[model samples]
Target: MSIVIGDIAKECITVDPSTKCQNVYSMFEEKTALEGIVVVSEEKPIGLVMKTHFFQKLSTKYGFDLFMNRHIDLVMGDELLIVDYSIPITEVSSLAMNRKQENLYDLVIVTKQNHMYGAVSIRELIMKLSELQIRIARYSNPLSGLPGNNVIAETLQEVITYKRFSVFYIDIDSFKFFNDTFGFREGDEIIKETAVIISDTIQTTDNEPSFIGHIGGDDFIAVIPHYHYEELCKEIIFRFDRYIMRFYTEEEIERGYVQGINRQGILDNVPLVSISIAVVHNKQYPITSIEQLSREAAKIKKRCKNITKSTFLALTE
Candidate 1:
């Protein structure tokens, strides 16, 4: 089973917003393991107080007299980072990275719906992410080092839960022919080159970060926001077409095709390699499962291959 933030979330030591600072300090003193505590009101987490900052304030001369009796909320730090308990650890890592550098070590609050569920420290978040990375690396493709089928299924399930995303199924056209005509080493280069093309296209875009995974061989998958999927696909197909021929020999470039054995072992002239991308989104249809998405994408990809050029087809209907 995939891991989520809730799996590692620690039970938060909490204080009522109306509690005095001295009482909160006592809770910290008694529970030495408590690095921080959430300041909650009406069952909602409103603020956070870290032990280091809390003690720093009390260490100042006359600080105890000034703040000892004040409400905990008055001394609590600004609102804490709140995340849903069900969110995957990978997504949480991204959120953690975007936090202010000064507060980089701050604890993140985990919640179920609007109420506080628990809390997780930056240290724990980093450790979980590191472990996840190691596990994924073991299953990643040997060449591109991208996540493999297991990670792809996990990512797809996570993305579809949002109920609004575009799944781009990417495949190479005439890839078998290219492999048969060229040597296996050259075919490997084409696969790697395709990986670079898709990767660079998505990385350079200003849109929200998307998940890209290798589904093995010439097939890849990208889960992106609906708004950015079309533009991303356009960029990938265009860049691939413009630079793909660079890998071919001068003769092959001039001939614009390769001589290879067809699947039936008959001699045939196959066109140069091109890309076919099929996009399926929940904008118009309710895509319920990974199997359904894959089947639809395969159907659309077949249509794209019929075009005889590098192109993408969106399944809007």
Candidate 2:
């Protein structure tokens, strides 16, 4: 049994159409997932207002004071895209995507008849689709969706618990030049493809369970049980280097391309996509904490980035 729209939807946040905008903003702040509030009157859904509308109104000539003076009805979206509890998750996802395309809201209110029932987020919809055996094209970078720093912390924690592992921090050398030359989207695709390759390489071996995490942008981390550290890093570097070459134009690959210097005075070039990797085997140092292990791995990663002109690998003693 697949998860359905009704199974995943959160209870809807509702407000009277006459509610003051100030109150709405306060409530919205309290409910982080409250993308939009459904306006109801006399037990019937009437309109919808979103936080973006509130922010836009805030930036007007009146600014924050407008919240005190205006009613939600004044800012509500009149034409709403809503789903019923009975709607199939697939149909709900389509409706949600259409709403996102037409408007920037992240959620849609689900209702029964005219009364509000619940709301669904795009994240929830995607998860539901995955559960239903549907494969949607994921736009997020395969290595690190947002490439936020939290992934690094999580990887370290995993190592702390497991005790005997190797941590490899990987970076692409001269990625900025490629981005500058081929356009950012192409650079993004290359990064995504690189992430996929790195992930696949690390997980392929039959050694202890390994983890691959994106540290955002061009940085990635792979955790392998101590037994497989050597083989995994070698495989990752080999596969990543091979795959990266395919992303460049033949001329650019052959002749290479130079990039303008930034304020940092580093000569930028569209060189062959190479990776600098720092590997640390936990059994040797036996890190007692996640933070210390992460700091050490990051330090080594930075060192690899600094000394190597192209691709380099360093292992912690």
Best by lDDT: 1
lDDT of 1 by residue, 66-177 (tens): 9999998888988568888877677777788888885677898899888889999988989888898898899899988888998888888777776478888899988887
Candidate 1 lDDT for residue 179:
79
Steric collisions counted per model: 0, 1
- How well is each residue in 209-251 modelled by candidate 2, as lDDT tens digits? 5656676778777766664566666776777766776765677
Provide the overall lDDT of each model, using Cα atoms, as 2-decimal numbers: 0.83, 0.67
What TM-score would every model get versus the actual structure?
A: 0.80, 0.49
Runs of candidate 1 exceeding 4 Å displacement: 1-11, 41-46, 79-88, 95-102, 111-117, 154-162, 200-210, 225-228, 249-268
What is candidate 1's TM-score against the reference?
0.80
lDDT of 2: 0.67
